[model samples]
Target: MRFFNTEGPNRADDHYSLPPLSRWDLDAILTLIEQKKYFLLHAPRQTGKTTCLLALMDYLNREGRYRAVYANLEGAQAYRENVDAAMAVIVTDIAASARVWLGDTDAPVLAREVLATTPHGSALSLFLAHWCQRIPQPMVLLLDEVDALVGDTLISLLRQLRAGYPQRPDAFPQALILCGVRDLRDYRIHASSEQAPITGGSAFNIKAKSLRLGDFDAEEVATLLHEHTAETGQAFTPEALARVWELTQGQPWLVNALAYEACFEQPEGRDRAQPIGVDLIDRAKETLILNRVTHLDQLTHKLREPRVRRIIEPMLGGTALGEAFEEDREYLVDLGLLRRDGAGGLVIANPIYREVLPRALASGPQDSLPQISPTWLNPDGSLNPDRLLDAFLAFWRQHGEPLLASAPYHEIAPHLVLMAFLHRVINGGGRLERAYAIGRGRMDLCLRDGAVTLGLALKVWRDGRPDPLTEGLTQLDAYLAGLGLDRGWLVIFDRRARQPPIEARTSSHETLSPAGRCIQVVRA
Candidate 1:
């Protein structure tokens, strides 16, 4: 059975996949290749860049217009800055690819000859020149993992390519496409011997264009899910289909991982008679996050980077990122951690990411939390808002300070600490959802525990900032309206300078909002 693939590049015979060429501008690619232009095909780690490149190579070769060979340069990564060793690995890999893809057995022999006669710095260039000279058809090189090399190795590869750019189909490949996770311009390659960083652009300015392989759109997501139904006679309910799109926003890896979890791994999902539903999709999402699967784990790992933290911390706490924004924001967008929304503003890529990021950040604090009774639960098993608020106040007074120290991002420590507490409150039965955005000055959370649901808004009162009470109440009022709840909590963290210790000032009170909605105000 064809299934959603999570481990690696998609293969048509085994995996359910869309046409790779449809992900980007095929005409533009054709134009570049026809013009004998060197360019880049880049995207996030698992957005199917390799799949697209392989497909392009196959398409080009089948047309008999160009002899296209796809080679992965990841083997060179092991050699690091050893330019000579890395060149040997790359040349041999290209030769192997040519033998397999083009049925050309002589390329491997050419590789050994090239390495022996040519200098390490120019071995790749010399090898490519020799291969093109041997081949009758104009050759195209689709080089994957172009960004895998570091320092001098990367510099040498780029420079060699640039040096050979003037030679056409006879002396070098007619066209070359470098594929990796970032654009060539994003690489600030620093050689060990050089005092300053060298940008990839300077090393290889021959790139004519940069093509990004993008995620699937909504229709593509639905088409993939329905493919299973067509094949197995099992269906996804309308709600489940919409839920998948909502949670994933058409991110290819996420879309596949969620479906693979729900349809294959989950015991009940294996029965073709039982259709997939929203509940199952929700469970699948939870499973992916809880299992800390490779994809999610890698996504969270990126959060530790300072460049990532600068934007994410403010997004988590719902405040402006200040002036340190421009280039860093672009970097995040390129990394696929954030995206340009319909309004041209940056947002956490999708809903699932929005949930996973904070939870990952709070995992440290969540682990160190002290034990407490489920005092917030009523006899009937639903949550009691009043009781839950009381428990949180007590928990904050006793352990909040120490727990704050465990949080990874200190700027949003209070938010993480509270999220940690709520995660405990769920006790495996409910979910806590959060919504925060840059420059919003508020973080809204909704807790759904069985029959009970509570809405809460979090705000931080910083040293130079005005009190967030009025702002938070208004925000919570809007939030409650969205959740269709009349009453909710507004918890404001007092981070102002010289503030009293947490225990003495942590308190709550009931108040009426401007909209006359009932709100419990917690000042901690």
Candidate 2:
């Protein structure tokens, strides 16, 4: 039976799949190859790059114009700056792939002879030169994980590819495509041998164009989900289908993982007689995040990087990104954490990422939280908003100061801590929904449990800013109106110098918004 593929490359017979080549500009790829150009095809990791390269190789070979081979260079990453060692591994991997997939008996033996003769810097160029001599058709080399090579190793590989650029069709490969998580130009290798950083552009100046592989569009996403229905006779409801698209925004691994979880992993979802619904999709998403599935974990792990932080921190804190932070926008987009909106503004890539980022940031403080009674839970188990606020007030009065240090990003520490506290309350049975954007000056949250949805808007009183009490109330009013609520919470974290300690000045008072909604204002 065909199932959603969550790991490695997709297999047509085993997995409900899409044609990999359909995800890119096919005509452009063919044109580049026909013109004997070297280029880059990059996308975020685990987004079917290997699948695409393999499909392209098959297409080229079947057309009988090019003897195409695809090799993943990730294994060579272990050698770091050792150019000879890295090059040997690269040659061996490529030659083995050609032998196994293309049924070529000469590549392996020829590779050994070349390795014995070529030096560190020129080995790949010389190897390709020799291999092209033996093949009748022009060679099209698809090198995957090109960015995995580091330092002098990466430099050497790029230089060698560039060195072979002039010898195409007859001596060198006719067309070479480098595939990786980021574009080749973004690679800034710290060359130990050169005692300086070598930019990828300088090393491989012959690159014709860089084409990025994008996530599946809405229709493609539906095509994949419906494939499961066709195979198993278990269908996804319309809302479930839309939910999946909303949550994943057509990210390949996420789409597959969510569907796989709902259709196969969860016991209730395993019953083919019962159709999947929005609730099941939500559960699958929560499981993927809470369980720290490899794809989400790997992407979130990048959140700790300083470069990533420089781009993401401002968005979380609701402050304008500094002019300098603009440089890392493309990098973050390449990482798949953020995407450009229709208006060209940067936003978290999708709903799933939106939830995961805050949840990930709140994890540290959540773990640090001390034991507290579930005063927020009613006798029947529904959430009690007043009691929930009381619990937060007491917890913050006692532990808020120290727990701030536990937050991973300092600019968003208060937001994280408050979220951490609420997460502890809701972990039993609820959801915390959040919305904050760059330069928005406030973060809106909706806490849902059973039939109750408690709305909130969080603001900060920084060094030179005013008390923010009025602004907080107005923002909370708008947020509550959106949620169709009459009242909610407005939390203003005071960060100015000479502010009173939590024990001394933390307080909550009732106020009315301009719209006359009752707002409970909390200042700490």
Candidate 3:
């Protein structure tokens, strides 16, 4: 009866689950609690932080060493417009959770009494002070989705907790853990009491540490899948496991989603008894991405956020503004969109995410448009860039005007359209690596056709600038230097210099520099 859990917390009986506490770094967390230290627990959405905290709460409460409660403040989202209303909901939710777990409904009454008596600016701190005074054992509070509260409400919560820090073990919660997608340090909150910026370090100043719950390791992922094999006598071939890891990079939701699709959704022919293999995983990836399921859709919805766009645009352009790069880079990493690359800097988190995102964000035409023929691909499994780009240029001349007319992604339409065209051709055959960045001069794309590696560098020009041979040659030289490539192709999207209708668009290849390296220029 066990199944993959794509939704909320996994149950031992209903879902194939990991050993309680086995999936998290619980020892470190417990050490913080024992030392009376406040800390952070964060990871991308649905990566099991809430589940881990709930389990930890149970362990602590059942041990009878402390009173622990896990409370989600997300319900306070509605109070975003009214600070007083938001505070009331927060206090009530905390009280309700405490009542259920601590056998203390009166907790709220005492908290409200404290708030009524305390000074206007410090009500929450005083309320927590009162509640802590009445509780018998030391308390461990796990605040989930604390980042969901915006502006002042967030500041109040952090400041209140900070104010109550000195009363640990008596009148305050010992071992407070704040959980959200962002670390506490990223919180930018300002309050009426202080005109200056309130760094999280100052507001939640007592935090002894910030601990991010990481995704499962590859071995752990295999072990999770293996449990199903043990129970149902079905097996996952080694190739399948590798495919899953390559695609998901051990992301929890993705891991579960791939397995769910392969085992349950794949056609029976492909889901045969011969241990599930790489082909099945590939098929699952294609089907899931093409279908645009709720989980994938929700994650991409973040693309509309300005912060997300700021980070993503540079990646699409293959260059990033150096200033403040680290902070935004860390934010994207925490979002699970990018991961550290030992030598290559930061790369997209995984192949599946890389493949899914562009398509997911591509406008309506890309999704609903007619499929391009595979005629451009050679029988030797090679893509003739000269032919492909030329053919695409012709197609663009004919339909690009119409497509770009209604395209909402006007600034990046050229890139998306080309990517979509390439994706259609390489849909089932090869992998295309997309590297673009906001304000970065060029978009670098690497096409891997088994043994052949082709690099395409695209530069965008706004005005009718003269031929960019000198600048383009220099940039290409630097890019080729890093890529260890000798020759490559460059496509320039000159906003003011489109080919004269039907008669002028053409592709030309020529040698550049004393080295006489080949570079193709496709003017469209």
Give the best candidate by lDDT: 1
The alpha-carbon lDDT assigned to residue 72 of candidate 1 equals 97
Model 1 alpha-carbon drift over 4 Å, by segment: 191-196
Q: Note the Cα lDDT for every prediction shown.
A: 0.90, 0.88, 0.73
Give the alpha carbon lDDT tens digit for every residue of 1-524 in model 1: 99999988889899988888888788988888889999888888888988898899999989998999999999999899998899899999999999999899999999999888888889899999988998989999999998888898998898899898899877899999999887747356866566467664588877788877788889999999988898899999999999999999989999999999999999888989999999999999999989999988989999998878988998888877887557678778877889999999889999989999999999999999998898998998788889999999999999999999999999889999999999999967899999989888888999998888899999888888788888788888899999999999999999888999999989999999989999999999
Q: Judging by lDDT, tell me the better candidate of 2 and 3.
A: 2
Q: Which structure is stronger by TM-score: 2 or 3?
A: 2
TM-score of each: 0.97, 0.97, 0.80
For model 3 the TM-score comes to 0.80
- Taking the tens digit of each residue's C-alpha lDDT, what string does model 3 give over 130-194? 77777788889888988888767787777778878888879888888889987747455544355
Supply candidate 3's per-residue lDDT for 4. 75
Candidates, ranked, lDDT: 1, 2, 3
Report the Cα lDDT for residue 497, model 1: 80
Q: What is the lDDT of residue 400 in candidate 3?
A: 64
lDDT of 2: 0.88
